[model samples]
Structures are given as structure tokens and as C-alpha cells.
Target: MSAKRICIEKDKKTSDDDKVQKVVINSLDYDSLAQIFMLLPVPERIDIEGVCVKWKEACQLSCLPKEINEIHLFFESLLDQKQTRSMRMHGSSYEASRELSAEVLYTIFCTCKNLKHLDIVHCRNDVAEIPLEKWISFQNLQYLAISCNMTPDLADTIVKYCKNLKHLRINNRHHIINTALKTLTELENLECLILLNCIKLNKESIIAISNNCKKLKRLEISIRSIYDPPSSLSDLDEISKLQYLEHLKLCIGKSLKDSTIIAIANNCKNLKSLEIAGCSAITETALVALTKLDNLQKLDVSFLHITDSFISKLKGLKELHCDFCEQLTEAGFIQLIKNNPDLKEISVLGTDSITIDLVIAADQATKHRTNGIILHIRKYDLELTQAFKSIIKSQWLVVK
Candidate 1:
């Protein structure tokens, strides 16, 4: 056999199409190898432990080929296992002793240029300061999620490197300011941005994001506080600039007004999905404006005060979630069943006032159709939390 054919056959046995289809990488095994496995599309098909063991053996035996693009080996754990060089770690939770070092992370970035997605969740071990010169290693990275203990400087370093990033989710417990968000503006291709439990992002940061991330299509924001004197919901104007936006989630626990909701409905006309949970300012006015949006398919207006009039107007809605809407009693719910013939899923997690009779009324209103109804409620009624569930079970019998 020819030399080339023999080499090809040997590599072919390991690179079988099926094996390539089933590769999963988990952290408990070779953390570095598992990361590399994540770069593969078929990581879900293969056994995660098996892939890690294989990579561990490959690294230990120094058997890794230089041209291997499918496998990513981030040896930060290995570097920590054997301290080589100093690496500056920036996250809030820094447990990696001077022994683990940042060289491993640096080395991985340098080698894995094809990394398309990167998730650094709750792992921040920076031993010494690494120069920015090494930051441009992971240029192809597209999806990046850094949560729990995000570092501001580290976030800048990542944005500088991953300029082509599409989805960015960062949760900074240390309280990041407008600077970090401004830095993210450079990622022109960013599509999905999530800032969950971030204590520092105020209205200014929100405005900056609206002005800069023009291409953003999906956003999840959790603001610490909203003014009680009923600050005008003018920040939505910034959101309106994002014409291509499809999904938006706003968790602002402040006194909101009807004008704010109207402003949002008018501006974010392209919104296919919307979630406004725990915003006490919203009322039937907001709900009324929302129904006018012909494109809205899924809506979650939980923990808000909506009356029977608003419930009756949602005839065009497909999926509706109204959990903990204390004011939404059986009268409003029955109105929803009677008015919204196209309704598919209804979630009433804490609307305890709704009884079994109301459920029957709802099912009857729907022409006794059981195929399209999926209700989520509690199992018992003794606890305050169980009311919604009991109501759902009682309603289920009526549907049949």
C-alpha cells in the first residue's frame, strides 16, 4: 500500500463519520478536551466521558496531531495541575492558586482559533497578568457566555478578541458599568444579548445598547430598580431603534405607567415575542396596546394587573402566560376562553381565585376542544401556591 493511503486509512479509523457525529465533552473528564469537543457539531451524539478519556490519553501520550481541527484542547486545568507561567485572572471568584496559572487558558485560546462558541461559567482562575497581544487568539468565536463572576477587564479582553461574536451573555456580580457595555458595541455582529442579575446596568447602559447594538435581535435585561414616583417609561424609545428585534424580556421591578407600555407597543412593532414580568406599573392599558400588534405570537405578562377587558382582547394571541396576575379572576379568564379561540397554551400559576367551575366554563367556551389546551397549575390547594394547579386539574376534566 502507498504511504499516503496507509496514513489515511489509520486516521480514517479514528475519524469515522459516525464517531464524528457522536462527540460530547464534559468538564469532569479532560476539561480541556471537553471544550474542544464542544467545537464539534456532533458533540451530542458521542459519549462525553469517552471523548474526554480519548483526549486525555492523546495529551498524556503526546499523540495529538498538529492538523486536528475537530478537537479543541484548552489545557487551563492541566496548566493549573502543573504551574508553568503566570496568567492574570479577572473574574470575582478566583480560586485557582498561583499553581494553576493562566498559561493553560492562554494556550487554549492560541491553539483553538476555530472555536465558534465559548462559555466560561463560574470558572475564573487568573494567576498572573497575560498581555493583550495574546487576546486575539480566539478570533472565530461567535457565541460567548460569561456568567456568575464576570470580570470587566476580562470582558473587554474577550470583545477585543472575539470581534465576530453573535450572541453575548454576561452576568457581572461585581457590578459592571456602561464601559463594559460600550466595549460590546464593537461586536457589530452581536444578535442576542443577555444581562441577567446585573446590579449595575442602569438606564444609561440600556440607552447605549439601544444606540450601538443596531443588529441586536434578542435581549434580556434585569434592572436592579426603577423609580417609584412613576418615572416615564421613555427608555423604550431606545428599544424602538432596534427595528429587527424579535424577542425582548424586561424585568424591571419599578412603578411603571400605561404610557410606557403604549410607547413600547408602538415602537417595537416587529416584536414576535415579549415578556414583561414583575413590572407593577403595567395595567389594562398596556395589555390593550399589546393586542394591536399583529405580529405578536407569544406574550408573558405575569405578575401584572390585567382585568377582564384586557383578557377579552387577546383573540389573536396564540400562547399567553399570565402567572401571578392577582387581579385576573375567573371572570377575566372565562372572557379569555370565550374571546381567544386560537389560544393554544395558558399558564395561570398563581391566579388562585380561579375555581374548577371556571375551568369548566373555559373548556366549554372553547367548544370542548381538548387537543390544543395545555394548562400549568399546582398539585394541591392548601398551600397558597397550589391554587392555580388545582384550578387547572378541575378545568382538565371539563375539557374531556
Candidate 2:
């Protein structure tokens, strides 16, 4: 309690502070640092490497895609007498009272400097709560899939900060205005983009994406539902501008038709995967047009008016998803399967002719093959589906 005793204590505290300051991240060996890195979120762990050379090396060691753990330790041995606290002191903290995971965003932006992939889609935190413009720090972010109310400011923040973003997906929210979508198109390096079910996304937005993100390879757009989009009538023609497109999924109701399919076949020569689901206007002619694309490996014309004639024409397809084509006969479906020798997956989920007999017959046809075929049957087929698991196994996805 004396002044002399207090001064001695103060000197001791100052010495401890100096010791803490002297201890750098490189002071720890890779194994010890890697152990600590393993405890952080995967993105943060990957990002931590950007902190320093030692951390980067430790990160690499920690993320080895090997079969087993590199280090084996005795519990008692690991509990050494020395104990140390982490140097990171002035960052985000956890508290249950806060409903939004907005804190998670702040922590990542400030701490995880080298984050590569960020998929907070349908996240509990409304990113609108975070001032993304102010906290714009995703310098190394390559992939981002988020669901937030798409304000112009939010879109601008993404376009500005997310320079390295190669893949971008904004889903589920409505009335994503064309201007706002245009703002996001500024991400020139974008290779994969998904903007589905955005009612306000019309021709203008599509044009913007095609114009700006020239590097885009995979594009999925669904701006129209049963009714037309709120903006101008959907411009299916503008899609041809994306000459580099390799994979495209369109669920834009009537906006996707035979002409669009034909244009895609002619322009997007590299098109590999094409899905035209929930489009009522598309006739079997669309299938004929799609057959022109030599690189097309996967075709999904689910809920379309595809018949036995057109479905049989499809050959060498890796995957054929013709879910709920009520017009398709058992014989025709079998022929379709027989035609595609390389077919790995044929999903006939809701087609009326997908009977136990049809499945059994298909299994019998494809059973003796070296590479297995996956048959997606209805949930009611579970009993027989399970029975077929051991022999002539169809990788069944029992859909409702």
C-alpha cells in the first residue's frame, strides 16, 4: 500500500507490457501457429497468411488436404507450464444479445484481409445493417454470394471494393432495379454471376452484365416469373453478347424460348450446361435448337412441354434433367437413356411414366456398365430404390 511498493509494481507491469510487445507472430513455430490457425474459421485461416511470411507458411501447412492429421500429441504433454494470450486485442467480440450477425461482417473485413470466398447467402445478418461502403475491405475476395436488400449504395460498394471478385450471386430479394444491377456489373473480373428471380431485372441489367463482365463464363438469370418482369419485356437477345459464356441457366418464364436457344447455340459455342426450367412457352423446338451446341453436356428442360420425339434425339449427354414432362412415354424415356451412352445422371423425377417398371427396365439396361448411372426417382420408390442400392445401384435422389 506504500508509494515505494506501488512504484515497484508499476515497473513490473511496464516490463510485462514490453515483453508482450516484443513477442511477434514469427516468435511461434509453424506447428504451434498452425494449431491456433486451425481453430479459426476456414476463410479467416486462409486470410491470416497475408499477415506475414511465417503465418502464410503456417497456413499452408495447416490447410494440407491430406488423409490424416500431421501432428500427434499426448494430452498431458501438450499441457505445458507456459501459457500465452493471443496478440489480437482490439477487434470484434461475441455477445448473444445482438440478433444480427453484422459483427461477423465487420470482423472479416478488418481481420480476414485475404479472404477468397464469402458465401453468406440467406445469412441471418441483413448486410444492409453494415455500412459496406465504409467497411469496404474485400481486396482478395474472389467469390461472394449474399442476400441483402440491393440498394444502389450496396451495389456500388461491391463494385468498388470487390475488385478481385470472379464469382457473384445475389438471390431471393425482389425488385432489384436495373440501375442497381448495372452498378454491380462494374466488377470486370467476374467469371460466374447469378441473379435469379429479381423481378425488376430486365433487358438493361442483362445488357449491363454482358457489356461489363466480359470475362463471365457461367450466368444464371431469372428476372421473370409466371407474370412478366416489372421492367421492360425481357430481352433474351442481349444474352448472345456474352460470347465467352460456357454455362447458362434461365428460368425466366416466357423470356426463354426457341429463338433464344437458337441464338445461344450460334453465339455461345462453348456452352456446356444449359437449364431452361419453369418456362411454359418453350416448345419441343427449343430442344432441337439446343442440339446444335456441340459442347452442350448437360440439358435441363424441366417443366417444359418436351415430348418423346425430341427427348430421344438427345445423345451423348452427361446429364439430362426432364422432370415432369408428362408427355414422355416409358419407351421414349428408355430410348433417351439408351442414346446417351455417356449419360451419368438422368433425372425423371415427376414424369408420369417413371413407374417402377420403367426404373427397373432402365436399371437393367444401364446395370452392367463400368461407370454407374444416377436415377432420380420419386420418394415413394424408396423401398425398391434401397433394394437396388447394392446391385445395379442408381444414385437416387428421392424427390417429392
Candidate 3:
């Protein structure tokens, strides 16, 4: 064959190979493919369903096998495309090989800057492969809830990075010290703070949070012992700073005394909802002081040895919980009906002394009207117990 013919044939072969390579490369550049969908002709795009097919293919490849990094990258890309406002990572126990818990959180926070609400519920307590402290800042953050096992250091790191945090729920059993507690002071916008089942929390920690977060509106805390009354009323006094407080839950440890609780109620007069669970030392006197807050809508004096006097003071109360109050008798229920005519929702689950007959009579007398009352009877009743259990359930929890 002649030299010119041979050259022309070689050029045609190379041109065909180039076209094949271009098609293969285009399939891999996902961003370009996404742009192509945006630029498609109206009629052709409608028939093609190009965007839907691409997303389905991407999601199947990324989320199907449960690859952590792939899922993370996919979410990041989606965030960039859609400008995601919130994200929740719940029970994503898809084999995270990370070492530091804080590190994994930091990476997520960094990638998702527009994230306003973040929920990491029931995650592994073990440290991720990476530490969280290295991450810079998350300026636009507002709400954060980290539940289950977590280190105190990670909590501190969060306080440092997420300064504008408004709502925080940390349910960790680790020991939280003063330094870590003080970190909350930096969060000026913090509105709601919940620390559930944190065994190591003490009075000092509460005091620090209250003192620092002056704009706080709601706070839920659990201490080491209810009886061990905090020598410093700093935390109690801090309530006055939060003039807008609406909900306050103090699950005192075994060390608190009657006075400690009274002091709290007396100070936070504007409180709308108060739950004093596990505060065994508190009595009727504290309840009387609580009634002073005429605005009190919901009160849970459960597990405390309260009597009829306490029940009478809460006349306008809405939701009342008296669970585990073994000392309460029929007199309390009778007084409740006679006095608190507005009493609506009530839970008297652990009060074994009150019979179902007495409860039914009270409910009937009340006419099951507005401000409904629910008498959650115990599982077992004595031989002399009233047979009104069936009636009570039918009237309140079931029908109403």
C-alpha cells in the first residue's frame, strides 16, 4: 500500500479510539453529568428522566452497601447542590473505622456548614479514628444533640467550635468537670440545654451553665445525689438571670434536702413547666412554694413523699405526675378533686394506697371535663383494692 493511504487509515483508527475514551471519562465525572441534566433540552430532558436516573444510580452505588466514606461524600455533594439546612445521623453504625468520636463529628460539621440541626443518637462511644479538636469552626450552627456514650473532651470541643449553639442535648455518663462545664458560658445564644443520665454531674456544673448561659430558656439536668444539697445557691440564683425560662427539670441525685428544692421553686417564679423527679427529700412545703407560681402549668412531683396538702395547692395545674409517691393515700385524690377543679392530666402510677373506686368517683365527679386527669394505677393491687381499674382505664386513657 502507498504511504498516503497508510497514514489516512492510521488517523481514522486514532479518531475512533479518542471518541470511545471521551464517552467513558464523561460517565465518571458526576458533576459534569449533573450539569448536563441541567442543560438538557426541555422535551428531551422530560422524556430522558436523566436527573432521576443519575440520582438513583448514585444513591444505589453509595448508600446500598453502607460505605461510610461514600455516604459522607454523597451527602456533601448533595448539600452543595441543594443547600441542605439540617442533617440527622441516627444509628448509622455502618462500620465506622474512625478512632476519635470528636473527629468524626468534626468532619461532618465541617462538611455541612449550613447544618442548623444535628442529631447523633445512640452512636458508638468509642473514639473515631480521627479526633474532633482539629476541626476549625462551625459558625452557622444552632442546634446539636449528642446522645449515648461520649467523652467529656468531645463536649468541650463542641462548645469551643460551635459557639452560636442554641439547643444542646448531651446524654453522656462520663465525668464532666468545671472547665468543661464553663465552656457553655461562651454560647450566648443557647436556649435549651438537656443533660440526661450524666452520672458525674454535680452542683458546680449546673451553676456554671446557669451563670454563663444567661439567655437560656429551658434546662434539664441530673445530678449525682439528691440529698447532697449544693452549698452554693449560685445555680439557683442564676435562674433569675433567665427571665424567660419556661421549662426547668432538675432530677436531683440522692443528696438534695427539702430546702434545696424550696429554694429553687422560690427563685424561678416564672417557670411554666417543672419536673422534680428523684428528689426524695422534698415534701408538701416545697409544693406550697411551687403553687406561688400561678403560671405553673405542668408539675411532676413524682417519687417524693407528698401528701394531701401538696395536692390541694396545685388547683390550676394541668399536667401532674405523682408516680412512685407511695406515701400518698385516698385523701390526696379527694383533695385534688375538691380543690384543683382545673386539674387535667395526672399520673398516679406508683400510689398503691389509692383504690380504683376512689379514682373512678373522683373522675365521675369531675365529669371527665376539660383539664383531664389520668390516674395510672399500679400493676398489682391488694385484696381490698377497688375493682374500678377497668372503669378508670375505659374513662380516661382509652376513651378520652
Candidate 4:
């Protein structure tokens, strides 16, 4: 081959390589690249963080959807030694291999500037040691779910800094006293609050929340202590002030009375779902008051003093849970199904009087009205007949 021919061929090959590289680099603009990254699954997006400097920078951009603003910090080590080394090489201290430290959490908060929701679960008790002042920087946080024991000071800091917070779920098994709840009263814009197994929650704290956070729409409070008096009933007067409340679940001790239910029905007319489980003080009178609530769709009177007569009056009830109500009889159960044609789900578990025949009658009555119905009766009821057992096993029948 001639020298000129060989040189020309080499130049042509080099020119083609340059064109390919340029096309790949300039194919998508910065915003387009960030949008594509946002569409990727969590694991794939994390993978892109280690691809190169450009990808890691793209991941930090605010072009991602608001749904992805949530960050779940898991305490358990999930990364291998090799992965940890790679993260360090990329200058990222957010290690998945070791237990999350306060410094690492702060780094995450800084990187995710647009972070609105954060869930810190299965974290060590030492997490409380992290200064609340550090969290002041994350002022845009709108929702926070923490399983750790939060101190009054920390709670105060959260209410002070996270002014835009709308939803909060604190599953602290430790004693959460009134001081922390009083601090929460400062959050006037708070909408949804879920307090599960908070041992020290009392009437005073509940009243503070009710008086201050009038904008609250949904609330779920479950007190775990056995000795705490039913003082929460008196606090219901305070809760009655929240006319904007739509959904409420009170799984406290037997303090609720007819007046309490009447107060809720009269004031919170917007209430659509209500769960008063373990309120043994409630009776038929309360049910009569509840019947006035035209918007009430779901009712949970489990472990309460309710009978078949009271169940018949719930006109708009779509879901009724009367588990462990021994007074409910088969005749009344059938009457209930006939009366509330809109009823979609019914739970009569632990009721000894509900027989297989009654369930069959109830099912037949509602089957044609709607596509289907869900009945959660006692398991022993199914043992009376094989036909009933087969019906339960088949997908056609929905039982729990």
C-alpha cells in the first residue's frame, strides 16, 4: 500500500471517533438528562450517582419529582466493603455499609435541598444526641416519620424550624409527655398526626393540640398504657373545636361517652372515617348520635358496648367493624345488611352469635346490590358446613 493511502485511512477513522464522542456528549441538555435520571428506579438512580462526576451532579439537581423528595434513612448496614470504598472515592460520605451517623445525615440533608419528607426508622437511641439545631437548615420539610424517642427540645426545634410540616407520624414507645405536645401546638398548619403507642399522652396534651392546630384534618392516637384514666373523654370537648377534621382514630382506653360521640357528630360534620376501638363506655345512644353524621363512611366500634339494634341505624356506613361485640346476634346482623345496602365491608369477628346461615343470608342480600361484599366473621362459623368452608376458600368469597 502507498504511504498517502495509509495516512488518509487513519485520518478518516480518527474523524469518525470524534464525531461519535461529540454526539453522545451533546445529545441531551442538562434538564433533559436530570428528568431521565428522575424517571429511573431508586437503585438505578443510585447507580448513576457513581457513574461519573456529571451523573452525580445531575442527581443533585432539583428537577426530580416531589414524590422522590422522601428520604428513608435505614440504620442497618446494607453496603459491602467494596461499595463503601467506591462511595468514598466519589467524595460521598453517605455510606450504606456502616451505621448512619449525625454528620452523614446532615450531608444527606444538604445534598437533598428540596427534601420535603423524611423517615428515620430503626435508628439507634443515640440519634437523639444529634443537635436539633442541625435540622433547622432543613426548613422545607413538610412530612417527617420517626420511630425514635424524640425529646421535648427536639420536638420544639422541629415545630420551630419545620413550619411547613403538614404530616407527622411518631411511633415512639417511650413516654411522650405533654411538654412535647405543647411544643407541637405551635404548628398551626399541621394537618395529619399519627401517634402510635405513645404511653404518656394525656388529655392536657391532646387539648393543647386541638386548641392550637385547628387545621388538622386527620388524626390517629393510640395510647398503650392500661392504668391511664379515660380523661381523654373530657378532651373531646377540645377536639370538637376542630370542625375541619375529616378522619379520626381514637384507640384509647374506655373513656369515650355518648356526649363525646354527639359532640363529634355535631361539630365535625366533615368526618368521613371514625375508629373508636376499645371505647367500652360507648353504647347504643352514641350510635344514634353517629347516625346523624351523613358523611360517615367507615365506623370501627370494636370492643365497645354495641348491639344489633345500634348497628341497624348506621345509614351511610360503608365499612363497619364491630369485632368482639358479643351482643351482635344473627337476626340483627341480617337486618344490618338489609338496612345499609351501601355497606361494603363488615367485621363481626369474635361474635359467638353470628352463624353460617346468617352470613349466607347477608351475602345473598348484598351480592346483587353491589359487585361483592366483604364479611369478616368468626373462623369457627365456617366449620359448621363444608359448603361454607368451600365458599370461604374460593376467591369468589372474600372473608377475613
User: Of 2 and 3, which scores higher on lDDT?
Assistant: 2
lDDT of each: 0.61, 0.67, 0.58, 0.69
The candidate 2 region of ten consecutive residues with least summed lDDT is 81-90
Ranking by lDDT: 4, 2, 1, 3
Model 1 per-residue lDDT tens digits across residues 1-400: 9999999998898788657556443223444654564464332323332344355332322222223233222335556433222222233111222222244445545565665655553335531145556667668777766554445576678777778889887766655556667677668889999887754555666677889898888988786764323354466556767777789888866534566567668877788888888877676766798877878878888888887678777766667888887777777777776665666667777666557667657545654555665433332345533443444433433221
TM-score of each: 0.66, 0.68, 0.65, 0.71
- lDDT pick, better of 1 and 4: 4
RMSD of each: 12.7, 10.8, 10.0, 9.5
Best-performing candidate as measured by TM-score: 4
For candidate 2, write residues 1-400 as lDDT tens digits: 9999999999999999888865964588766776778788766764675576667556545543222111111122234322111111212211111122243344445555555666666455676677675446577778887777888888888888889889888875666766788998888899999986655565667678768888889998777453345334446667877889989988877766667777777788888899888877777775687777778899888888888888788766888877777888888878877787667666777756765566666676665656654544442456556665544444432222
Give the best candidate by lDDT.
4
Q: How far does residue 142 in candidate 1 sit from its true spot (Å)?
A: 1.4
* lDDT tens digits by residue: candidate 3, 246-287: 898877544555665566666766788988877676667656
**Displacement of the residue 246 alpha carbon in candidate 2, Å:** 2.1
Return the TM-score for candidate 2, rounded to 2 decimals.
0.68
